[model samples]
Target: MSCSCSSSTNTQNELHASIMQKINNHPCYSQDAHQHYARIHVAVAPACNIQCNYCNRKYDCSNESRPGVTSYKLSPEEAVKKVLHVGGLIQQLSVVGIAGPGDGLANPKQTFETFSLLKKYAPDIKLCLSTNGLMIHKHIDEIAKYNIEHVTVTLNSVDETGEIGSKIYPWVFYEHKKHRGVEGAKLLLEKQLLGIQMLVERGILVKVNSVLIPGVNDEHLPFVARKVKELGVFIQNVMPIISKPEYGTKFGLDGVPSATHKQLMKAQEACDVNVKLMRHCRQCRADAVGLLGEDRSDEFFKESFADKSFEELAHHYDLNQRMKTHENIETWRRALRAANGKINQEEATNKDELSSNGNTMLVAVTTRGNGLINDHFGSAKEFLIYEAGDKAIKFIMHRKVENSYCMGKENCNGTYPIEEIKNALSDCHLLLTQKIGDCPQKELESIHLTCDESFADEPIEISVLKGVRKHFFTAS
Candidate 1:
C-alpha cells in the first residue's frame, strides 16, 4: 500500500511538470514567459473565410503596425526559410506561430504546410496557430499530428441568439454557402465553441482572443470569457478593437473609437471572476517578431532601422529605457505643460459647468509610454497627469515619485512610506494603473485619492476622460 501511494504521487508530479513545461515558454499565453521568450509569426495564410466588421487586411508602406497588417507574405517554403534565419539570429526564440494576415485554418494547405516544415526543421520549437475558429474543427487531425500545442480562437461573442454576434461579425463563409447577419454569427460561435472543446479534449492548450468592441461586444466579452473558461481555455486575451476609417470596415467608417484602457479593465474585472485575463499581448501582426510587447519586424525587414544585431534590436525597443524620465526633467515638464495648454484652449468650452459642480478633476495615470496605462502602481516610477472635465481631457504634467509599495516583503512587518508617494499625487483626484495591492489601496483611500487598477495599455487622454466620467458623473 505504501509503494502504491508513492507511485501515484510520482505520476501526478510528473504530469504537473509536463503541463508547466508546455506553458513556460509561450509568451502569448504565459505572461511571465514574455520577459525571456520571443515569438515569431509567419504570414503564410492570407485568405479569411469570415468577415469581422473591424478587420480590413490591406498592406501598405505605412509605419503603423497592428494586427492584420503584414508587409510581407510568404509561401510555406519561404516562411520556413525566414523562420530558420530568424531562429539562428535570436537565441530566445521558443515559439513559432501562424496568426493571420487572415485565418490560419482558412488557408489550410498553406497553414499546415508551414507547420510541417517547422516540425521538420525545428522539431523542438513549440508550434501555435491562431484562427477565427470557423474552420478550426476541420483541421484538428493535422493539428494534433504536427504536435501543435497552443491554439488561439478569436471568439468575439458566444451568443447563440446572434443578438450581439450579428453586430460583431457580419458574415462567415462556411461549408459550401455564405452565412449573413445573425445566422452567420450564430454559426461562427457554434464552431468556435466546438473547436475549443475538441482541442481541449485532445489535451491541447487553448487561449481565447476576444476583441472588445465598444458598443457591440464590450459587455459581452466577460460572458464569453466565462463560457470559454468552462470549455477549458487556459487564458483569455480581451483586445481593444483597433479601428481606422481608411481600412474602411463598417465599424471604423462609422467612427467607432477603439476600446479605451478603462473599458478593457472594467470588462476584465468582470472576466477575472471566471477566467484569467491576459494583459501582456501586443495584438501582434501576423509577421510580428521579437519580444512580446515590442515589435522588431521593421528592424528585421525594413532597412530604415538598419542595425540588425539581436542585442542592438532588443535595446532599441527596451521599455525601461523608453520610459526613463528625461534627464532635463524641467524641460520635459514644460513641454507637457505647453501641450496641455493648447488642449485646454480648445477644451475651455464646457469647463465652467463641470467646475462649478466640482466635477472637473485631475487624473494621474501610471504608464510606460505610448499613451498607455501599462504600469502597476507598485512599479510606477512616474505618474502622467491629465486634466479631465465633462467635455474634454488633456495631458498636463508628469509627476516623479518613488515606488513606496511592493518594496518590502509581503509578510514582513515594516513601515511603508506611502505618504512620500502620496505627497506627489496629492493634487490628483484619481489614479489609474494595471494593478495595485490592498495595502496601497487602503493607503490611497486614506488620503481621499481613488486608486483604480482595472485598466492597462490605454491612451492617456481617453483613459482620463473615461475615468472621470465613470468615477465622477456616474453617481451624480
Candidate 2:
C-alpha cells in the first residue's frame, strides 16, 4: 500500500514538473513568466461564429485594449512575416497566438495556415490558439497536427440547464445553423465541455477564460471553476467584462455595468482554491504585440515589415539568446521566492505577538511582479492586495484599476482617473506604492486610507509585515 501511494505521488510530481517546464516561458499561462516573456496575437480570422452580448468587434480601435479589437487584419503570409519580423526584434517573444477580432476556429484555414507557416519558418517559437471552443472539438486534431500545445477556451458557464448561459451568449452558429436562447447555450456548453476534455486527453495545456459578468454569470463562476478543474484545465483566467458603452456592445448600450474590483475579488476568491486563478490578465487586444501590459501593434503594421523575408527576419530570432535571458530571469525568480520565504518565516515567528493586540488590516501594493513594491501610483493598472496582521502576511487578491490616473504630468491636467482609483481601493486601510502625488494621496486619506512610500522597491511581504507591525501593533 505504501509503495503504491509513493508511485502515485511520484507520477503526479513528474507531471507537474513537465507542465512547469513547458509554461516556464509562456507569459499568459504562468505568473512567474508574465513579466519576462511576450506574446503576440495576429488578427487573421475575421469571421466569428457565435455572438456574445458583451463583445463588440471593432477595427482600428487602438485606444482600448480588449479581445475582438484590432488595428489591422493580417493574411496567413503577412502574419508569418510579421511574426518573423517581431520575433527578430523582441527577443522575449515566446508564444505566437491567434486570439481574434473574430473566432480562431471559425476561420480554420487562416488560423492553421499561420501556424503552419510559423512551424516551417520559425519552429523554435511556440504556438497557441485561443477560441470560443464552440468548434474546438472538431479542430483538436488540427490543433495537434501543427504541434500547437497551448489552447485557451473562453467558457463562461457550466450550468447544464443553460439558464445562466442564456443571459450571456444569445446565439451560437454551429453545424451550418444558428441556435438561439437556451438551445444555443446548451449546444455551446456541450461543445466547450467536450473540446476541453479532448484537448486535455491529447496532453495539450488548457487555460479557461471565463468573463465575470456582474449580474449575469458572476455568481455562477465558482461552479464554472469547479467544472473546469474536473476537466483537467491547467489554469483559469477569470477576466472582468469590459462593458463601456463607447465600445458599442449590446450589454454596454443597454447600460449593463462592468464588474467592480470587489465583485471580481469575491468571485475569484471562491474559485482560486480549486484552480490557479490568473489575476494578471490584461485582456489583450487581437493585435497586441508586446509584453502583457504593453501594446506595440502600431510599430509592426504591414508596410513596415513588408520587405523583410523569412530568413532575414529569422536570423534575429536566436532562440539560444532567448533561452539565456530566460535563465537569468529564473535566477531572479528563485531569489525572490527565497526572500519571500524568509519574510514569511519571520512573520510566523511573530505570529503570536501579532495576534496579541494588532488590528488586522487589508493592505494594497503596486508591483511589476518580481515580488517587489515597484510600480508607481496613478500609473498602476492593477494593485497587489494582501491581508497583513494577526495571521501570516497573505496575498488576498489583485484589484484592477479600470483607468490609470495619469501617465505623465502633461497628460494629467484634470484628467487623471483619480476618483475611479480611489473608489477601487476605498476599502483598503493602507496603500503601499513606490511614490504618490500629493493630490491623490490627500484624496485617498479622506476615506481613511493612508499611503506609505517608505518601503519603495522593498520585498512586498517584508514591507507588509513591517507596516502592519508599525501601524497596528506598536504605538506611534
Give all candidates' CA lDDT scores. 0.74, 0.84
Residue 165 of candidate 1: its Cα lDDT? Answer: 88
RMSD of 1: 15.3
Top lDDT prediction, candidate number = 2
Which candidate's TM-score is highest? 2
Clash count, predicted structure 2: 0
Local accuracy of candidate 1 as per-residue lDDT tens digits, 210-246: 8989888877777897798799888888887888786
Q: What is the TM-score of each candidate against the true structure?
A: 0.65, 0.90
Clashing pairs in 2: none
lDDT of 2: 0.84
